[model samples]
Target chain A: MSGVLTISQPGNSVVTDLGRFRGPRYGLPVNGALDQFSARAANILAGNEDNDPLIEITALDFRLRTDTDILVAVTGAPVTLSVGGRTCPQWEPVSVRAGETLAVRGMTGGLRAYLAVHGSVAAPVLLGSCAPDTVVGFGLKLAEGTQLEVRRSVAPIRQPYFDLPLFRLGLSRPEFGTELVVDVTDGPDIDEFGDSAGLLFSSSFTVSGRSNHIGLRLGGELPERQSSAELLSRGVPVGAVEVPSRDELLVLHRGRGVTAGYPVLAVVTSMSLDILAQARPGHTVTFRRTTVAEAAGALRTATRQLENLRAAVTTVFGLLGIGAQPQWHDLAPAVGS
Target chain B: MPVNAAAIEVHESGDSALRVVAVDADREANWTTVHRLAEWLESSGADGVYGAVPTYDSVLVEFDARSTSARQVKAFVQLGLRQLGHADTQVRAPREFDVPVVYGGEYGPDLERVAGQQGLSTEDVVRLHCAGSYVIRCLGAPAGSPMMDGPGFPLPVPRLKDPRLSVPAGAVAVAGRQAVIAPATAPGGWCVIGQTPLTLLNLANEPLVPYMPGDRLSFIPVPAADFGGYAGRYLEPAR
Candidate 1:
């Protein structure tokens, strides 16, 4: 028999609640599970595939209810997690019986968190996804009294021990004090700025409060065109820093619209989004120039590290006599070329 | 990557993907070619293609490096392009939608201001707006903000020098030669002429947004009294 697990946040959690609409809708942007990495990690701990649907909590305010014992893991945004109204350690597997309530009191710094259960949530799918599009009214934004049915799927014998992510994959450790240097490449409007435009990388910018899932408005040196040219409206890539007429730097986010006409400066690397997603409204953000080759290298290293983490978790769990599946498979499929 | 290929420019976009740009203008001329290539690769049951989002002018095809290599997908795309000269079908046909708007009242607080700036009466502004049919030029400024272009009014009205932090949803705004309706309550800088009760977006609907690129749109002057009856249907059903 299938039981239920319901989790929710107190208020709007941008990445946590914003997911793709699982209903009929073409324009609804998928806004769910911000830290895909952590979500996958939590799923692995539950002996579930990386793609298992889970609840992403922001700034605490999460409660898990069940009629049967369910294996779960909490990850992302160092939140003080409690089960049945009692404090417990996070980033590890915890089993909860029926009627147990899990709550995240608050967060240390990061803005979003992920809660994974042993089975998928019973939410309708739109565009082949179970995520919600809150802004566009697509899917369920776990409000009060949202009941999520959990299937009693076969649980893997081995479960991986969950740990926090590293600097590249997790929150920035103040000790790492390694300034978050985001690498960017030229954009369609890159040449719009004079040679001084290249100087943009040499300067620092602060994240403005106006930032949102749509885009990040950066404050600092503005890039301009050498001569005013009306750019034909075209598709904008994520991370593309667009300079609208106001001269404010609008860094496009993952959910940015398809087309735009603003003068673009550069696009941030994918690795930087992890940091960008966590950046508060007024965090210092700096851009560093990188060649196409360098960007490829960075991506390669990041992908490899992620693969290694999945492998490590698998190895650790296998040693525990639990035959947990590899976690990386949760994201992209593992098809041989 | 494959035989019968033109020059291709590649850029590393992020830690997970690379962008291969095809140099072309005349967006209309390339739509079929781009769509055909993207569709062929996706339908080929090829591995590594994870996130492939197609847009008006380009297609961003992402893949997992572990499962597929860029060179592999590039070669596959090149193979499909060799047949680009063959007969093909269109992607999505352009559609026409008539949007009803209520002008010059509590629904549109700035209607008087816009009329004053344009040297036209509030009624005259409505006449001009309804008289012209607009083309969907682009969608931007905010998500789902449709930028339509047509024969603009005789006098150019400037946008509010100050943008409202939160304009009501379904706001019908005009700036220069363009006009649009906001899909959500968002900060806007356009001159608000009125608001529409029509929901341009509904998550529960098959297509989140009712309008598409190249869709022709016309603004119908709607009465404020009839708004309440039509408002809920336009929005997604309350879950």
Candidate 2:
């Protein structure tokens, strides 16, 4: 079977991974899946590596048709996932025959969803990643009728996708909705914000439409600072919450710059990034203060869950006779029939 | 100036990264040391440490938290900190860049405004900018945007009260005695007085921007008609 997927209705879809390795040092933002937990879940369920390139569909109306039989999964936000008119539950692997239409629509919860096909996106890898950053001229957005070249392995499935008696998999996915309470630790320059620092936790800020992979802009009651003094530009992390002068509060994300001029009022916990990334315009956002120890523990727990997930998915893939090519996994090389 | 652990304050930048602020009263000295520390960490093969980004006052070190704990990464950072300013470590040689610019008109929309603020003719402002020596203070956001010192014109001009929503890439801008070339189209507050046709930072040419801190810089005016000739060429820094 020809391994190709044609975009029938591309809704802001782009190839993304964990972004380029060490991208910040070269002035490139880490342009990857905003909600990584969902991305990994989609991949694991599809019998692919966690960080493999996959399609990240934003908002709604993302539809594609497969040119070959493949195992796939859709995760992130509560969405209507339909394959050839058959509705399927998310986070579960499904077999799609050639010429079948896979549609994801009516996202009720999150703003972005991850679609992992059991194939590799045939996009040119720049600096160790297929993720595109328009600022750097790396890759382009997927267009309607554009056929994405995919490399597939001769993986076998026991039966049809809709008829498979698979157990529903439950994992620790962040709650996605219109409202979000993000956990944050102390930022490097928290002291300069003065008593106004409490304003961040006290007020609810509405997400702005201007937000993107770079950062999320929140508009609401402005927090005044004690100093108008010039702070030298410094390297900032992705989760840094910045207070730009006379502007809205900005939470830096994956596509944020390595450095900025704004003063950081708080730093969002890494575990909360998945929830923060899915926030849409007009979404109400509140902050919760947390200790550093708790933040690290959250990540530790998530890491262990993913490790166990990989083991479970890999075992199931073996039982179903779905094996990847030598390139994907040499230890379990597939005998392409 | 001696670099010490006490002089550097490490703050938690999310769970996976650390923001190390170098406390030095002198801005130039602070950035120079920060740049040195970043270069050392990169050139050496440090385990678990991903990358270190240096700016005017601090460094952000992002690491693989799954393999390394925050305490382990912090210890690695401390080890790297101790290696700074040592005579044994090879230092990056500073170079010079002659950036070509097309001043005035569409390329420099604020040429007239900058001239008026400085109480001089636009030609004088251009000439002074061309003659003034500048140094890249740091490479930063929006794709290695070079923040620089010495605009070559008089007066430490204040930034725009309302920053322009979109400053085009390659636009030569100045604010508060500093000059910058927008590496990409982004929101900025600096006065755009000119533009460079040469590619400042491109992955195909060089991953890192050609010039770094301590590099000498001076602008050269190019005829508007000849601007197209220099487009797409890499910025070649010379010693």
Candidate 3:
């Protein structure tokens, strides 16, 4: 049941799952796939559950050799994917023969890409997930010569051409235009900045090189706190836009610590988190104020799309006379939901 | 009487989370109420409640927005507050620990600077620091890192303007009026006064963290030569 996928060239990749959702209670960050939509899409295409462990490659140069025939899919930023010298398409399932070398090279758009394989990638699960959290010293950062043990699933599905409509609609790529506009809702400490809270939406910030999974550090005009009193440390959710003492803003991400002391001006909407995840160093970003109702609506729509994807996958499996994995239906709602 | 619903300010953290903040003036009372509320919410068989995190002055309740709304979470919290009316919440007794520490020298490089800032001799600084009983305010920053609050020094020591690249685990440090022992080697600004031999966060142990919020902590100064024995003894499982 177990097969090995040897990393011929790891590039900048890490093993990540949907994230460790329940770890925050124990003061652990909910580290997961930064571009969750792309991760899920890859999982769906590979005939795996949405939360199955996958490879998150940043600045793609990943190469792997499979020890057994494996169903695989690549999603997220547009990249050149090749298997045994034959160019393969992104955002669709592809089968690779045993000992075939699959290479993903030169991502053109988004900063990160997801490579999901059929069946579970057997990794040590800390807390409840296999997501690599570098901050917590958990999980692995795949490198050249790394061997990933995978439990091969025996599904009967064999479709030559299966394309999801959502993939054609540019749903996989992050919105990385000249200016990335992210939607945010007012945070608990919004009023602490007084009238300057409006500055959060108005100011344009450049993502600093210091940015990582922990947070996206932005260099720009920071909103000044009207009150001189210090804020008590409290639980901060992922996507919290925290303004510290320095002239920089930090948008906490999936790998953020459990608690933070800086005043959080706004929280990025769940739907817009994927956009932030793809923001590379030097990208200019601006926030747009949105209401909770609108944010919730956006999240609901995204969840429904994933649900549709799940159904579509089930249909494809059924049409091909393959049994749909029951675990695929257990896809949890995206962050905050 | 139960704290009035109006007394607590509910702020929407995001679409799916709400932060219920206690009035800032009464630190102890506010923290107590928040802790009790958090305990109640965790114990309650309420649908859609993801989890509640209690801090010094607030409880952030994260709910499943797919099934529950922010408004509904606030209402549930208000109901819990009402139910707590007039009843003194029986909190678990604070667990007291005598942490053996080796002060000054290699374990704590900032001890001399801390002593100088306090206008006291190095011996006197360690004596005063170990004298006060500290209370764990929260476990945060890093997993199982206890943030404890206690009596302040004669002159409060400020956090390092330039934080250290890496502070070793078990390095007991002070910043503002709070004290913390690093759970893992991490970059921090706190002034390190001593290092404890006890493992603060051993995942292999039955209880991962040695202390939780509301626990009492007191430092015991020990000779550096005896540090190894204490470290080994603390790591031993109870027979």
Candidate 4:
């Protein structure tokens, strides 16, 4: 099958072969399918491990092509999807016949969308990850004329529906005009913002357009600082909320500089990574200080739920006499019927 | 009235993560101690420590909190600080890296301005910069950028009032008392003097970034004409 996927924002979109470079050195930061859990869920529905590389579409406009029949599923953001010009339901595995093109247009639920092929798209592996970081020019972004190798062998299965947890599908119901509550863990600079900063700790913040893969530039009341001395450069982590000014909040992302000189007020917890990934620019983001114990508990619960989903998938396919083993070959194309 | 001691000083950022505060304000001693502690944790392989990150004056130790206790991790950090008190800072030599740069012209659009701001000739600026052996204070900026310390000239130049939307890769910038090399093209505010040919930050690499906080840097100047030659050299391995 032959298809074409074009990006409205060439600077905004990319089509990368799986795993081109080793780590995050592909010019841009690794900005793939933001909702990784849902990306994995799409794979599981196709009888694959959640790790397979899928089409991570930003603002949709992704198209799939194949000469033969294929099975596919859409996860993450809900989009107006069609296969050979026929409408279909989302989050369900749909199979298509040969020479059919599947197209996904503009987002309806979230900012990003993902399309998983029956057999995983063939891309080179770098540092054991197929995800592409266009910033550093590591992995490839999906683009027109980007020829990907797909396994020709088709083992078609007629599965009715996928029984995955709604949360696992990463369906986000974004509340526009409201501050997004992100859980935070205090940082070394937490105490630097004096008693008034404590007021900040208790207050909320709004995500500004300045937010990007590097970090979120937050606009809010500055946390009080006990000392005004400049800081030395140090490392930062994903989801870190660092206030460099009296009224500025910078929330770090995955590509946050290894080190920073700004005093971090708090860090966004991992439990909220999927949620943070779904956040659009200019969205209001607020912080609620959670107890360490509560944070740990939430992480454990998320991990457990992830494992349970994997187990459920295994059981369902196992009973059907299918190997059900996690394989790249099980994923279908993004444009599914 | 008895003031209840500051609440055990614990906060949450993420569900699976926790950050321990060593110092709240900017204290040179505190920052150094934090770095020393970070170095210790990285080498010790303490339980639950995913990575120890140091910023201006504090260090952030990230852990799988689920696999390890925050209290235990804090205790480990305390122990590392105590150990730093006795460790010889001079025993281990710093990592040395040589970064080549293409000075002036398009590669360094702001070089003339930077030199003029320093009240020196373009050649004098390069000479002053290359004359000294610099030490890496940190890898600030974006994930792979390096912040180094070199000899201060006549005066400490201020940062760009408004940061550039996109600073080219290998950018050699100066602000206040520090000189830094931008590994990748990201927005920056420092006064640009030249552009380096080194790709300091590559997430694809094993260590993600090649330079470290305690590393030493030597800047080698290359003519603008030779920029293409050097750029080609670095691209060889990338391809």
Candidate 5:
């Protein structure tokens, strides 16, 4: 029920989970998957729970050798998957034989990729999650010679060629590019900037090098606030677009601190968070204003689509008599039990 | 009488969260309202309420958009405020702590500079710093890093124009009318005054953060040798 994965080549990657949602209560950031949709899709394809621990491969050259047979799915940033020199399809469940090396390389169109195995990757869970928060020194980073313990014995699920369409349909394939139009809702401090708030939507910004899970610092026209009054520190949620000292625009991300002193002019919509996650350092972005109702509607639609995908995938697995582990059973229970 | 709906402004932060801000100009009143609202939210066990983080003047209530809307969360906060009334809620007797520190040495490189700026001796600066009973306004920047507001110095101790690349953990620093202990080594603009040996955050403990908002803190100068022993004795097992 346990297998060891030895890291032969660990690209810039970290072990991540759904992230610690309750982290803010302790003044800690919610450290989790940057692209949650892709992470969950990988988990569903791997027949594991959506919240199960997975590897977030940031750099392209990630390689690992499994000591035992295991089922795994690689999603997010389009990457070439290979096992012992044999090319394998991304976003589909692939069984790696014992002593075989799985290589993920030539990443394109995105900044991160997710690798989810059956059952879950066993790691030390601090504060209810295994996602790495480098700021707090929590969780582990994949490196060469690192050993990853994955629990659960996976049985290979065979599928006919006709089932490929259904499997492909269930997989999440996000278009990655340099220019992105991110949707945002009015922030708590939107009025602080007065007329300058309009500039946020009109101006284009380039993602600066100072970008990480904590925030995506944008280099663009500085938006000035009307008043120079000292504002009190307040809770800053994920996707907060904060303008600190009229220097640069910073969009807080999953690993953002609980509170920030700067005024937030807008918050990125939940639907566009996945697109923002794929933005690279040189990526250009423009904020598109959206109503809260519209943003919420879009999020609901995205969520419903994911639910439908999960149901379709579950049905396909059931028809094939594949006893795939129920990851997100809220959509549909595993039928072939 | 209706909790002065005008006194509290509920603003939407994104589609899923609402930022409840007390419009009181008085800092203490604002914090008091936020703290009480946070307590009510925590105790009410409201469904779809993820959690509420109390800041200096506001509380951000995060909710599950799939289950609840921002408007619903605002109504919940308003209802909680109405039940509590306009008068400030009874402030609980804050838990007091005697934090031991070693000042004016390698631990506090800027101690001499701070004392010089205030036209006081290093000993006088330490005395003035330890004299006041500081209240923990909030825990921020990092986990368990308490931002305590205390008595103002003889002269305003402005933050470093150029922040240090890193300040060691447990380093006591002051900026404006506030003093804070570094929870972990981080780049900060606060002027370093001293260093404390006390552990503010320990994951091994049941309650990760040793102190919370509204706690009272006082510093006691101890020799470097006595720090280790004093910390071991003062450090309480997380509840």
Candidate 6:
């Protein structure tokens, strides 16, 4: 059944899906959840469409009171999730009774946590997505006292709470730590760095506090250019490692601009992008060089894993009499321009 | 090289996108080639392709690798480019839009600074800014921010070396012969000249933005009192 959730503690959260699609034509960036793998896992566990909207809570505590019974899953970095003061398991669906309060005490591992309801978190859709993009003025923030609608096209979940946790499909979670060995492929302008091109991979950089959704500002040995010539403006893809005139090197994310003028030295791989999403400010980052073929392979593997999860979850939902099933195709995090 | 007379190159962007770049050409020719390719991809009904974003000298073709690999999309794009070269047809004219701006006040804090830099009065700065019909060259980065090109000042204006950390949204600024509007609040380095009240992007309004690349925009000076009336309204272009 459909329900309402009132945010008691927002905790820098926003509703996100695969992000706003087909936005580049209108000069909008593709902004969605920072970690695609975790978001997909949560969606699969909750038996919701892969692109359904979910709450992305960032590095803080959150609390919400519900008006009806629903199944939910918390993914992304490890966190202490609770329903009515009793701790609940993450990465798996748990039923919450009507009028019970759900809470995320704090993130124990990574920087962001995702909460996916079995029905899906409902928000106003703009263009093709309901993802909150402040820059484009699409959806608003999930602040305290905001009433959120939890919608599902199917009937209310009918499975018993005791039988739900039996089908725990194991999915490997990405390791998080103070230091990260990020994989990257060559960008279009790698040769422009001359001798400094090698330094980009060899040097250990510190993520500056100024870093945010747009990109991560790295402080370390700067990649010096061989020429003083100005680079012409061109399309800047997400994950491009740009070396601007400033001292910091930039690793663009989903929220970066559609185009830029800085020299690109490398591009983070699609699989590794999920790891970078959880990287905190002041964390040590070391670049590991890889080929485009390898990068593309990693992306393929991620999609395949999700497909397997979708298949397993489909059978489980069918057995439980739940109608909604996961459609993993086109669920991959959109490549930002 | 497959495209006759046009020097265009397509490079893989990470694993999910491909960038079509123009090689060794003037700004006009570069943009012309990129925009044509972007338009072709948008209208070609190509599957697995999401959208193409045309910038100053390139077009970023974003696609879904799951449904179709970059290799397949790249092949399709190459074939489309060859066909585009064979036809070499010009696109329809861009729509014209009049952007309402309030010059030289709180809306445009650097209007006086820009005038002083150009050795002209604030009135001259505003007059000269509104004199030329500009074209939206590209959009990106922050949000729906657009960089425009036009018959600008006689001399290129230098950017604020110590750039403002937080330039207000709708602020219109210029640098060299290029102009840009801050679609939202962010840092800016260009010399501010005026501000427009028309929202550059709002999904509530259909078509998202009234104009796209190649569209013409001319600024119409309005009193600060009238700026409020234009607020919350999308920038609708006049055909």
Q: What is the DockQ of each candidate?
A: 0.25, 0.67, 0.61, 0.32, 0.69, 0.61
Question: What is candidate 5's lDDT per residue for A196-309, written digit by digit as tens?
Answer: 889898889999888888889998986778887877788988889988755678898888888878888999987688888899888899989998889888877767776776
Q: What fraction of the true interface does each of the listed models get right, in terms of native contacts kept?
A: 0.22, 0.69, 0.51, 0.45, 0.68, 0.66
C-alpha positional error of residue B163 in candidate 6 after TM-score superposition, expressed in Å: 2.8
Worst 10 residues of 5 chain B by lDDT: B230-239
Write model 1 residue lDDT over B1-239, tens digit each, in one string: 12112534455444334444555565444444444555565566566655443444444555554455656666765566665545354555567777778887888989999888878899988888888667664444355666676436886667688889888888998876677788877677788888888877654554456665566778889899988878565632121
* Candidate 2 lDDT over residue span A1-337, tens digit each: 4577889999888988877766788777877888888888888878778889898989868899986676788888888999899887788887777788999999867889898987656676777788888776677488998877666644435445867657455665668878799999988788888888998999899999999988899998777777888777788888899878466988998888877777888889877888887898889999999976788888778888888877888777766566633434222222231
Q: Of the candidates shown, which would achieve the greatest DockQ relative to the real structure? A: 5
Clashes of 6: 3
Clash pairs detected, candidate 5: none
After superposition, which runs of candidate 3 have C-alpha atoms over 4 Å from their true positions?
Answer: A154-174, A324-337, B1-6, B86-89, B205-207, B230-239
Query: Which of candidates 2 and 4 is the stronger one according to TM-score?
Result: 2
| lDDT over C-alpha atoms for residue A31 of model 5 | 76
Candidate with better TM-score, 4 vs 6:
6
Question: How close to the true structure is residue A223 of candidate 4, measured as C-alpha lDDT?
Answer: 70
What lDDT is obtained when candidate 3 is compared to the true structure? 0.79
Per-prediction CA RMSD (Å) = 7.3, 3.3, 4.8, 6.7, 4.4, 4.9
The C-alpha stretches of model 2 lying farther than 4 A from their native spots are A153-164, A245-247, A324-337, B1-5, B85-88
Give per-residue CA lDDT, model 3, range A78-143, as digits (tens): 789998887887887676877789999987566888999887576777777889866446788888
Query: Could you list the iRMS of every candidate?
Result: 4.7, 1.6, 1.8, 4.9, 1.4, 1.8
lDDT by residue (B1-239, candidate 4, tens digit) is: 11111212333434434444454343445446556666677789976666665655545566766577677776776666556666555434577777788888877777788788889998888888888678676555554566666556788777787889889878888877888777667778888888877666655565566666666888889877766665533421210
Q: Whose TM-score is higher: candidate 1's or candidate 6's? A: 6
Residue-level lDDT tens digits of model 1 in A69-178 = 56677776677888777566566666566677777766657666777776555566766666654445445567666666665533323224553321122322221122
TM-score of chain B of 6: 0.87
lDDT of 2 by residue, B146-188 (tens): 7787665678777888888888878898877788888778877
- Can you tell me which runs of candidate 5 are displaced by over 4 Å? A159-166, A324-337, B1-6, B86-92, B225-234, B237-239
